[model samples]
Target chain A: MKKLINSAESLTADALAGMAAAHPDLRIDPRTHVISRADAPVPGKVGVVSGGGAGHEPLHGGYVGRGMLDAAVVGEVFTSPTPDRILAALRAADSGRGVLQIVKNYTGDTLNFAMAAELAEDLGIAVRTVVVDDDAATGTPDGTPGRSAGRRGTGATVFVERVCGALAEQGADLTAVADAGARVNAATRSIAIALTACTVPAVGRAGFELPDDRIEFGVGIHGEPGLRTEPLRPASEIVQDALAVLLDQLPPGDDDRTIVMVNGLGATPLLELYVVLNEASAVLRKAGLTVAHTLVGNYVTALDMAGVSLTVCRADERTLGLWNTPVNTPALRWGC
Target chain B: MKKLINSAESLTADALAGMAAAHPDLRIDPRTHVISRADAPVPGKVGVVSGGGAGHEPLHGGYVGRGMLDAAVVGEVFTSPTPDRILAALRAADSGRGVLQIVKNYTGDTLNFAMAAELAEDLGIAVRTVVVDDDAATGTPDGTPGRSAGRRGTGATVFVERVCGALAEQGADLTAVADAGARVNAATRSIAIALTACTVPAVGRAGFELPDDRIEFGVGIHGEPGLRTEPLRPASEIVQDALAVLLDQLPPGDDDRTIVMVNGLGATPLLELYVVLNEASAVLRKAGLTVAHTLVGNYVTALDMAGVSLTVCRADERTLGLWNTPVNTPALRWGC
Candidate 1:
């Protein structure tokens, strides 16, 4: 129960200040804990805004830049950003093209972002909101499959957030942007595994206890325990377990094109992710589906959990192409 | 030494296969270990390629998409990608426009990418290379800030990799791209702090040890030891200590604009990063340097080490603008 910090209460503020010092290209509105590119309000572009609790680095804040998100409103560690702060971010990211809010499906996130969108509309700024409900297994207690993960967005949300942001940057109107987001939500499915528990800075203890040589499947980003626990298996078997659940949640299809994402839950290495990808791909192929794209990395991490997640998106040509579009954020960049 | 895996020898290969399955858009050239977007050779775009070892997730491989890098070559573990793999990535990303290689400034990365560029030239493809040497505190064993490491690349490489990739994606020529990369490398300086050691999967043991209430400053990504070990200080003091080393490495000036980055080595939470950021900004402002932009997240990660790193870049209008450019990859997305 030890960490590097001055005081438990001062953790979030101190970290935000460090971020401002580290990345000069990002405009850190410390007052609101919102991050936007220094040269925000790009002429004629639809401003894209996204946020959630802290702990999931590079997801909301790190994705702030040109192609991904215009502004990211961060909450306290694993806590939702207050409505006022979210509104402020919406206000800042807004342009004549309008603003789109990428909200994870978590209860607090949805409520706050929804309120912020309403507030933006009250200000005569057109705003649309998309709630990422990509976590197929949500709201369920630990060790349950097909049970809801209680609003956990998981890795699939990364696609929902970034793809929507990308389209917004391309000047897509709020409706189109929201529709694109919904399209991804409808197509994407995620299942995560956790090898170790994370420790919230304030808490100063492991989020959960995982027996050595054991792993959990279908864990949430906020250390929400997990769906089930089992003995550690080969990377392939772990991939199978996660992918089985994900594929089952996806629309039944044979030969349908899908985008496969092998995401590390923070601590897992690229090699492990690749191994998970191999097994996940085999599952997809065995199910008679074609994997049109493969993305393996730490997209939506859960601190240092040392595990991986599999996300399968049933993508069409447009969604796939947009996935190919360029985005310049700290954690990801390429196709722009 | 307690890791959950069936075998360590087959880790990399198995992980690659899993990644291919999960993200179908990524084309995994297994033999070459070069990952590319399935729809590569995007019409009318200059191709950009990057690569290195397998441990760094979302780096060269995760970055291969629409906007950021056109392709990425992968190697085993922390080792550099082979010249042949780089050549394959260049060819895959090539769209008749010249190819640019964005390389980190490690010895292995430099030599391998250099050789690959020559090989690409021999193949009659226009290829250029830009190496990023952002670390200001050099000569640290393990290429980290100190010893007790096994080849660490602190997350600061994100600055050079993403910035360079963003420029290249915008159709910047090889020379311009390389120049921009070099500029960032020259302006940026990074230092890290570690709380606990990370164990490479193959090694199966922690790289180093720290007392329950102690902190190690100037640590590296690969679980390297640190330059200074002291009683675990407040997050504020940690930020100050890192800034002391990083700023000292940079050219002193009150007039220069700076970009701040607080990077997590892997396991450190977002809350801690913000804590570190808070203190860093105070110190920077006191130094009379205006903070321009900021990026805080897990950019370059060590293998789930409990640590964080700080990167400060002297930025101007040009660098800041480039940082905002659109990039499309699994991890980052900006201008769509």
Candidate 2:
């Protein structure tokens, strides 16, 4: 594969070193692979942490800073971090106000974070976990046979981290921070479409090949099979299809205010993301939803996939207030 | 070509609409394709304006906000903005304190922006122009034949816009702002290596292609021919070669502080960019330059090319101060 990397084996470590050099404000643990705030474990404040695979950058690591994640346990590309690494992040982030783990809804990540939470609690550190299952594409309605796994978390992880990070920074207790994260998770929904598959550095090939005239609808972040592959269409039609699925899953009321995030999976240009955002915003407005805050960029991504995910989070005064709170992270920084 | 665009003819307009929707704080003139500050022409503050082809996004448009460019005149992909369109942006950004035009050193961009400056001057608006020529790869020493064109401007335009933007926002006169921009441009050097060619939406194919195991060093943003095609090398070696050229072009003193920007050409992942930055930062430190500020992302891009450019701006205290000034723009926002 034509990638700007030394080798697949050293990809994660090399990137971590680069992160340390690029952001002096962040302290990277070479041994544990935990990226923590340079000034971590703030006394009397709840600590927030999250992590998953490595390819989706600016996600777990880029979000670590003064107002977002206290620590991020990084895994290899498309792989979950081990329980020990998660435990290490938890230990590093605990500041006596306890810690909240924002775990995405993936089998490996969910189990690993849970085990780590238990490990942290055993060490006398109070810990709470919030599972984010906001991807409406993989979700089913209540009482479905496969509904137990729930929706896979996607772009809403950013929303959860931002809002929950604000709450934690405000010296909220672990339970309160966890509750805020869960609340944001519940209010958020996302669906993605992939124009191309991303190649993991180690794989040296695309995860899947797409036909020239076809697009995958409801694709997952890790190239998981989407609901189906459909004939390629115009951007407006593609956007409408994704929006319909999202809105059907989480219908809005007239008075509902929503935060819309048009997230580029990977390799999608900002130009295209803006186009998708324009169409998505228009549809949301036509449906009588007030777009309170808009975030359009590559927040979450597959390594090099050309696609986008539209996320709509139902915002109330409390959620919007927390989102407006100042965040000074590498990826999502504003109002500070 | 696999792209998320409606049509080649409408790509620029669609992207502009998306930019307007994504950033409400910036004003986009549909008629002239000038992206300006919503509140422009601030009395007594010198205005800063820059523009070029539309493909290098977040370059001109994303830089328009409170502390950056007063206006950005956009053209069709890889094509210079018309003289009339550039004149429109100049007029829109003219304040009583006058205006500074930052033009990249591409032939068409330089000529058109210069013509626009002359037109603006005829209309009674003060205009001073700074032509950025910082690409070391395309440079020839003192008295070489054809040296009149100097070097092509590349990634350093971001540095020029930022430093000069701050100076203009601080009420510097047109001469002062233009001087700062020129100084930064002179002190900066950049070199890029491309692994793949980016396709223009209108072209419907890659600009060029290389063998599977070869890379083009010093490739221009518009896919201009580079210095040479070399066998694919590791990231460290690639970075070292690019840095050697940049450093040789603009050597630094023991105590000189510099800002390092690792910019991705459209499709390079952040993970790889950071890895490259990690190596680039180390070589600079070993060479005894103190990296004062680090920017790692796609600031300037070539459509969807998989490559990166490294820009090192040797900064004095004044340049660093200006670089640190608060900027609240769509593409680059911090310390607001």
Candidate 3:
């Protein structure tokens, strides 16, 4: 394993320290790696918090800011944040309205964030939890949707958290915010493709291996190898393969009420994201799926892995409106 | 050359189609690849616009939302968004309050966005432009601050767009918003390192070669190689090397007014980011440069290349306030 670092075990701590030094907008409790903006615990605003392992860049920590999350708890690479750290973030983010935790559908993350919420509740802070099982490819073997994606939260989690964060920041009740988040999660599904594997710093080397010119379809975000491997095909066909599964899972609707997310698996470039979006739109149009909105970029990524993930969320007027709400974080901002 | 897509030529189009088919909250003008929210041109708000190549994911496009950019224009991989495409986004984003064009330092992006701004002006729409040139290390080989980084905007551009977008959405005049963005660019400086090479789809292989257990310091975002090669070092030492150059160039300050951005070069994970941040902060603190804000993530990537970058911005009260303001995008969001 060839990497540049002082020590593998110390990588996470060292990295967090540098992050604190570099970004002034984020207040880093390096002791816990819980990242909040400089002026956290906004007066009277319900705080929204999310977090998980460290490999996924800008997901948990990068999303800490105004229109989105109030704080983010970061763990080591591919490791879930500890309950203590999460509790710290909750303590910081908790405001008069309440606090909501957006937990991804991962075993570790769910357990830790849920426990932290319980702890917060014990402290008399109103706390709510929403688990995002947005991966359509979860619960299945490696080939079919929900078979082999490995309990993935995929893309809509980012959207869900932002929408929920916006609602909470607007002083919505915890239940209302949690309900909105759950609804959004239920309306979303995702699938991914991988051309290459990522090298975890500690583990040094590609996480997995694929034959040249082969593609692993429906992979998880943490460098878990995908479900099926096949010879490489045109970008259009790849989109079709992923969309065929997604379309079948989505509610049949011509209602122009859906959001599209084309996420790069770590290393895929934006040009490829555009292709994915273009092909995805064409597939949806052919399948009578109406795309009401679109996002193309690296939302959830496997460290340096080369590929893309497609996430589709069925949006109602309310969800769409919430999607337009403002949020402040390191990774995303716009609607508020 | 180990990518999974069948062909490089159709990568962008196919990906866009896939995204459109999957998500409902996002829309793509299939013809133009401009990504917008489901309900664009929101009432009573100025439209914020930004665009560039497709390589940088979740940037201009992912950032298009209510509190951030109103619309994002995407070009081919590592290529500039065409004038026509940018003009389409400008038209889509126009809400009568005027539009702000937040462009990176690249010549291509600057030229294209500038042209689009001109075209919008010709059409009687108010337009403002801010060029981001935050890279410090690659700035001229002759030691000039703005010559060697190939006109790359790097991560600070994200800050420019977000704050400018916020002010624009808040009904700040084009000039005020542009001035704010320009100030951010002026205060910010960035430097990067690369551990390996990235494969551009068109190139179908690593953009450059690096020996095992080696890292190239001062690499450009587009994989333009690096200024120097060194044996791979630990996170602390790596951060030291990068911070050494970056801090040397920054104006001295012991004041509590600095924004630090520790960015992951494509393949580096968040754990490593924190480690890098640790060393960077120590260096900055020793230099009497107090960190008031910070962001650590894959803000500006170089495909799947493994490495990291550092960006430091001296902040004043207004800049700090602006940084804390709300932003809503697919990537970064925060205080609204």
Candidate 4:
């Protein structure tokens, strides 16, 4: 792999060191790989924390700041953080009001975060968990081997974190914050298409190989195999296909409002992400759904895969209010 | 080439449409491809404007807003914008206070922007220009073939835009804003190494081929041939070599403060960029220089090339203060 790293073993640690050095506001523990706000445990405020694999940067760690996440527990690339590490983040972020854990739908991440929540409860801390399963591509109508896994969590995790984080920062109780997160998760859906596969640093090879003339549809964030492979098509067509699937799965009413996010899976250019957003917005507007807000860029990524994901959230008054609330994290900073 | 573009001809327009849709706060002109603040001609503030090829996104367009440039003139990918387009931006951005043009040191960009400034002056709008040439790799000694070209402008353009934009927003006259931009440009130097080649959409192929086990040293932002090719090395060593060249070209005094920016060229991951920043910060500190600030990420990009560039700006009190000033734009928004 032609990566700008020292070695596979030191990738996470080195990146953490860099993150700590770059962001003085974040306090990164060397041992546990937990990144938390420097001034944590804010009195009377519910702590908000999230984590998953490491490759999808600006995700958990980048969201750890004043108006977003209080802490982020990081793991190796495409690997879930250990339960012990998650527990450390919980302990560090607990501020007396309570703590809310935002876990993705990945099996390992779900189980580990659940365990940490249990451990926090064991210590008499009020902890609530919200599992996000927003990926429409992973939806199995019925009887399937991995149907129990549910839809794999994807880019809408940012929406969950942002809305929930804003609510928690506003002194919302743990239950309210958790409910908001669940609400956002339920209203959001995402679908991704990859033009190229990404190589894991440790493995030094791509998880899968894609022919130059073809593209992978509904690819997961971790370079997982998508639903199927098809011949490459124009950006407008690709976006239309993704939108068809997303809208079919989560149809918005005529009076409903929507927030659109066109996320790039690392290596995709912002220029192209905008193209995808342009088409996606047009499609939504033509469908008579009010496109309230739009976000375009590489918010969540799969290492260095060349792909883009379109996420549509059917926002109500409350969800829109929470999303519009000011956030000042590294990745999603605005309205402050 | 695997890219998310509709066609080479429609790339710029499509991306601009997307940018306009994504950032409702910014105004985009479809005719001339000019992205400007929605509320331009800010009565008393001097107008700051910059532009170039379209590939290096979030540069000119993304940096247009409240405290940054009042307008950005976008050209085709890797191609200089026409003089008429530049003039349109200048006219749109100019208030009674006059306009300041921030042009990079490319022959085409310089000539075109200069022509635009001349046209704006004839149209009764006062204009000042700041030409940035901060790339250390293309530097020539006393007697060389292209010594008159000075240096190729690279990542330091962001520093120029930020400092000068802040100054302009403070209601500095055109001359003062131009002077600040020139100072930032004069004090900055950058060097980059590319691990892969980037394919321009129009070309449908990479500018050049790079061997798997080797890297192109001192590569230009436009994929211009570097000084030489060398065997791939560790990130630390690559950073050290680039820093040696940068410092050797623009050495710091004993009591100088510096702002280091580790920029990614398109496809490089933020995780690796921070890895580079980690080492770059260490080297600056060990040199006994005060590292006042650091910006990391893909501020300046070369399509989708996997490479990193290190930019060091030797700053004094005034420049440092200006850097700390709050500016809110699409790409570089913080401290607001």
Candidate 5:
């Protein structure tokens, strides 16, 4: 696959070791693959933890630091973390105040995180779970929208992590943090487009094939087939088409405020992301929403997939205040 | 090339417009392609300005904001900016304090910036220039390291902008900022490798072809030929080999403190970059150098090439302090 890796078997482990070496503030357990802040389990503050597959850079792991996630349990590339591993992260992250689990709405991820939460409760540690399913793409494999596996969580998980983590850092109780996450997830919508598929290290080939003149709209992070394959259009039109799905779902409100994220799936350059964001901002303004903040970069990436994803979240004064709060993480950092 | 661009003719302009739209704090002139901070020409503070070929995201443009470059003049993809455009940037960025020009060690960039500096001085604004030439790649076309256009500046350009930018933000005069940048350029060294060639949109083809089983070692940013080409090796071994070249150039000392940056050349995933940094730290320590800080990610990029570059800079107390100063640019930010 011509990737800069040692081997497919040790990809996640080697990466975690490298991350820990780079950031001294982060502590890692090599066996459990749980990366936590050195000062995790803050006595008075509620602990925040999240986990999923490891291919998405800066998702759960890079967000582990002050004013964000306390612990991040990592799984194999595009594979779910085990119940025991999630349980280990829960145990490591919780102090006296309890822990909150932010999970994506994948079948394996939800199942494993739920099992871990149940096991943590058996040990007298309070745990709460928030499942994020904010992808706005149409036509799942099953005809029903809410009946099948449901929309795969894509970009809203980033919102859930930031909002919930900030609230918890302010010493909010477990319920408040979990509720904040739920609200963010409910208000958020995301859609992605991919020009090329990503190759998993083990598989050693692209997940799917795409013609040069066509693109996949509403593609997922793992290179899953999108809602449909269509002829490639200009970047401006692609952004408008993606946000059309979001605008349809958003309720009309006067003086509405919004937070936008133009996230690169993997191999897309940061320059193109700014273009996507500029186009998204224009369409959002046309719909009477002010983009309060715009983040354009390659955060929450798939493994070398060439694409960009748009995340639009309805924000209030409180959400804006929390997002502006000082965050000191590897990927997202500002105002500190 | 399947790039997310409107057209080859308007890629840079479109990206610049998008960046300006995303960041209201920065002001841009479409005709001149000059981007400056809204608060540029801060009466008493020294101005920092940089420009080069476009294609390197977050280099000259993204570095324009508070505590960094006051202005960035952009050029066409892989082409140098015209002297007139650069003169415009110099004029806009200058306050009472003279402007310091940071130019990469490329033939076109150096010649154009020199002309611009002369024009700015003629218009009654003082100007100083620092040219970076830290690439450690072997086999220049002329076969002489000291002559024949010298080494093409690669990753160390980020260090030059940062350390010098921080000093300028702290009110360092033009000469002081230029000297700091020169010292950084002298102490820094960088080497890059490429697994695949990046395609320029206008060209509509890859810059060069490399077999799947081999890689170009010590390659320059524009798919320039490197010291040699060899069979693909594991990430760990490749890192060791790259460092061996640096170790030769680096003077040995007791308790030496160094700053390490593992830069991804655009298309490499962040997951693989951490692995490179981890191996680099191990090798640096084995050589008795104390690694003070390690920055890992795609700071300096080469379009869509799949590769990684390593930059190591010897640092003293002052250099470390300057590096810690808060930088609120679009790409790098910390320590407010």
Candidate 6:
């Protein structure tokens, strides 16, 4: 692989070193793999922490700043952070008011985060958890959402962290912050497709491959096999199908308004992403839905996958108000 | 080439549609390919307008919004916008206050922008221009700074747009705003490298190829060959070389404080970009220069090239203040 890294083993540590050097606002603890705001553990304010594998950048670590996650505990590429690693982030983020853990719905991630939350509680840090399972193609092969392996939380993970972090930064209690996260999770739905598979740093080759004329629909963020493979088509057609799957599962809210994110799966160009975004917004409008907010870029990503993920979250004035709150993370920033 | 596009001919138009759909705050005119703020022509406010070929996204178009470009005119990928298209944007942006055209120093662009400026002047709108030529590799093969063909404007174009755009938004007169852009172009220097060649949609193939163990140093944004080819190395080493070239040519400022941008050329993952950012910061510190501001991502880009570019501009309190001012745009947002 022609990747720009020191070595596979040093990828995470090296990247964290870079993060620490670039963002003095973040406190990067290499020993624990915990990246927290420099002034984290704010007195009397609820703390927010989120993390998972390291490949999907700016997700966990880049989001650790004002108005976003207080701390982001990252593991190696596509590997879940250990329980101890998660525990350290909890310790870093928690103040007297307690902390909330926003975990994705991967099997290892959920299990590890749960264990860490329990450990923090025993240490007198009251910790609450919200697991996001927004990926619509996680449960079964025929496009039915199930809970056996749980829906792999995809793009909406960014939304949960931002909204919940904003609520916490606004001085909401831990329970309330976690509740907000859960509500977002309930209302969000995501669908992903891949033109090419991502290659982990440790492995020098892509996880999978497809003929030039084919694509994997409903792919997971880890480059795992998706619901199925299909012939490649125009971007508009691809986005239309992805949006249909997402709309079918997106929870109903008080209004027919939504926040849309046309996320790039690492290697797709913004040119293509915008093309996808254009089609997605068109789909939403045709379905009688009003798009209240839109984000177009690589927020959460696979290592080097060429694909796009569409995340839609039902929105009301309250949720949008939370989204519009000032945020100063490395990845998502606005309002302030 | 495997790409998520309808066809090569429709690429730019489709992407613009998506851009317009995603950003309702910006009024997108399909006919002129002119994207201006819906509330543009803030009476008596200095109008900031920019345009260029379309492949490098978020460059000219995504930068259109509050405290940035008042309007952006786009042409087909890797092709300069015509005089009339630029004229349309100028008319859309001007409202009593004269318009400033911040352009890249490409032959076609310079010629067209000049023509458009004259056309706008005849139409009763005073027009001023600043042509950015910050790419360090464009001069001589030995890396000497010269004006022959001019240095291909690259990453620092973003810096110029942001700082100058902010100055205009702050009500600076047309000449002052254009001067600010010129000053930034003078102080800024950029160097880029590629691991692979970019594939234009019409071409449907990579412009060039590199062996698994080799790379192109000092590559241009448009997939042009750079200073030379070299064996692939670690991220830190590559960044160190790129920074050395940049520092060699970066103008001496009042102080050693500088603003650094580790820009991804479209397809490079943020993970790798941060690693480059980390190395660049270390190089700056080692050189006894202070990094006052840092921007890391695909702010400027090639369509789907796998590469990175490092840009550094000297920063004083005044420029830092302009940088820190609250600006809202699709690509870069901060300091509200």
DockQ for every prediction shown: 0.39, 0.75, 0.37, 0.76, 0.75, 0.74
Instruction: List per-prediction Cα lDDT, in the order shown.
Output: 0.73, 0.88, 0.75, 0.87, 0.87, 0.88
Which of 1 and 6 is the better model by TM-score?
6
Give per-residue CA lDDT, model 6, range A1-336, as digits (tens): 988888999889888888887788789998999999889888888989999989998788988888889899999999999999999999998888888898888889999999998899899989999888899887543445575777888888889998998898888887889889999998888999999888887988889989988999999999878888999999889888888777887766789989999888888888898898888888899998988888999988998888889999998787899999989888888877
Give per-residue CA lDDT, model 4, range B1-336, as digits (tens).
888888989999999999988898888999999999989978888999999998987787989987789999999999999999999999888988999988888999999999998999999999998888888888853213244677888888999999999998888988899899988887888989999999999999999999888999999889988888998888888888888778877744435689888888888888888889888888877766667788887788898999999999999888888888888998988777
Query: Residue pairs in steric clash, candidate 5?
Result: none
Model 5 per-residue lDDT tens digits across residues B155-245: 8788888898899888888889999998888788888999888988899899999998999998888899877789898899999999987
Q: After superposition, how far is residue B311 of candidate 5 from its true place, in Å?
A: 0.6
Q: What is model 6's native contact fraction?
A: 0.74
Error of 4 at B159 (Å): 0.5
| Model 5 misplacement above 4 A | A138-147, A251-255, B138-147, B251-255
lDDT of 2 at B321: 92
Rank the models by TM-score, top first: 4, 2, 5, 6, 3, 1
**What digit string (tens of lDDT, one per residue) describes model 1 on residues A82-182?**
99999999878877778888888787888888888888889998988877766755632232434443445767777887688778777777788889988
* Model 2 Cα lDDT, one tens digit per residue, B1-336: 777777889888988988887787788988899999878877888989999998887788989987789999999999999999999998889877788999998889999998998998899999999888888888854413124576888888999999989998888878888889988998898998999888998988999988879999999999988889999889999999999888988844434799999998888889999999989988998888888999998889898888999999999989989888899998888889
TM-score of chain A of each: 0.92, 0.97, 0.92, 0.96, 0.96, 0.97
Model 5 lDDT at residue B39: 89
Q: Candidate 2's error at B44, in angstroms?
A: 0.6
How would you encode candidate 6's per-residue C-alpha lDDT over B1-336 as one tens digit per residue? 889999999989999998988888889998989999888888879999999999898888899988889999999998999999999999999988899998898889999999999999999999999888888877654446565687888888888889888998888898889888888888888989998898999988899988878999999889888888999999989888888777887777888889999888888888888888888888899999988888888888888888889999988777888988878898888766
Candidate 2 lDDT by residue in tens digits, A10-60: 999999999998888888998889999878888888999999989998888
> Judged by lDDT relative to the true structure, which candidate is superior, 3 or 5?
5
